[model samples]
Target: MSNKIKEREIQIERLQNNLSPIRKIAGWTAEVLGDKIGVTKQTISNLENKKTPMNFTQYIAIRSVLDYEISNNKENEVLPKVVALLLDCDDELDEADYSKVQDVVGTVAATAAGGTSTDKLDTVFDVLIKTLPFVVPIIGTIIGTSANWSKKLFK
Candidate 1:
């Protein structure tokens, strides 16, 4: 083969490697991704496995789909869970709830960074217990238990 052909093949392999993580993180099976990109399941698998080189149009289509899905998944899955955990919310969170959680987390992070005292940490823990009493027992159990004991319980 020509040098140009070998270089093109290398580029295709790199693209496949770079895009494979997005495909896995977005929870798309090869068949599903192929459907979105207007290709066969075997085509996606071949590209992902580096068994074949993708054409320019195929590369464009796959890139577009992966980009869209990556952004959407970050917003829809990761951000909401992080906000909900920080806020200790048992209910479904909306945009407003997310904003409130973000503000509170920012404030707490800033306070912690500013050499906040152990007393202040205690106060925050008190407030957390008051705000979500149901979490107190869970927290107590975690704090009181040994790692080996917990592992043995599960086993």
Candidate 2:
């Protein structure tokens, strides 16, 4: 390969390597990309290795699909936890999981590009889910609201 091709190959490797979350969460690999885009596994390997250049659309599709998969996994992971919490599971969620549940949902929904009614609904639903947590980081709001409500109730 020429110097430019070699450099691009390195870049592809770096990009794929950086997608740790995708691999860890959703098991995405170049082979997965090839399936999604109708390319051969070899072509995906070449693109990812920077042996061949990828077009902007292909890059975007890779990112979009990979992120969608990862984020969907994250959202799915949270649901059982949240439901378990509602059922009074012994384990409490960490702050990060609480925060990330909405984030992952939002990212996946937003990437849908209005393709379906379900997609639009998901985007709206994710927005709402993500908004549900603004109260958590505010430590005193609930306490204060309770106090005020108590005062009114007693008065």
Candidate 3:
């Protein structure tokens, strides 16, 4: 093998070492991710196990698929946490407002579970629009209180 090919193989080996863990973190099985990347599950297994040398095309496709999966996972994870924090920080939500928030959360969670990234965002935005009457007040109160505190400190 040429020096360049040898270096490429080493790089592939290094990537293979971390691939399985990262894929698991993204909540994807080899078969699912392989389907998304247009590869066979056996091919994915081979790459992860370092039984087959991954070519440049496979590397690019796998990297792209993984990046997309990781991004979607981050979004799905963060959205609910943020919503929870916002709800927790607010002390004055009445029964009706709480119900609205719960509805929004349920919709967002359900969409995240099965929808594409765009679909998830669309669902979230739709829920936000529907709940804006109450949500805006909560958000405004949070922001206004923070601004007041900042002004008092500066003064």
Of the candidates numbered 1 and 3, which has the greater TM-score value? 3
lDDT of candidates 1 onward, in order: 0.49, 0.43, 0.53
Q: Which ten residues in a row have the lowest lDDT in candidate 1?
A: 145-154
Q: Write the candidate numbers in order of decreasing lDDT.
A: 3, 1, 2
Q: Which candidate achieves the best TM-score against the true structure?
A: 3
Of 1 and 2, the candidate ahead on lDDT is 1
Report the lDDT tens digits of candidate 2 across residue range 35-65. 9867777877776456776664564465456
Clashing pairs in 3: none
Error of 1 at 136 (Å): 34
RMSD of each: 19.5, 17.7, 16.3
Report the Cα lDDT for residue 87, model 1.
Answer: 22
Estimate the TM-score for candidate 2: 0.34
Clashes of 3: 0
TM-score of each: 0.40, 0.34, 0.42
Predicted structure 3: lDDT: 0.53
- What local lDDT does model 3 show for residue 136? 54
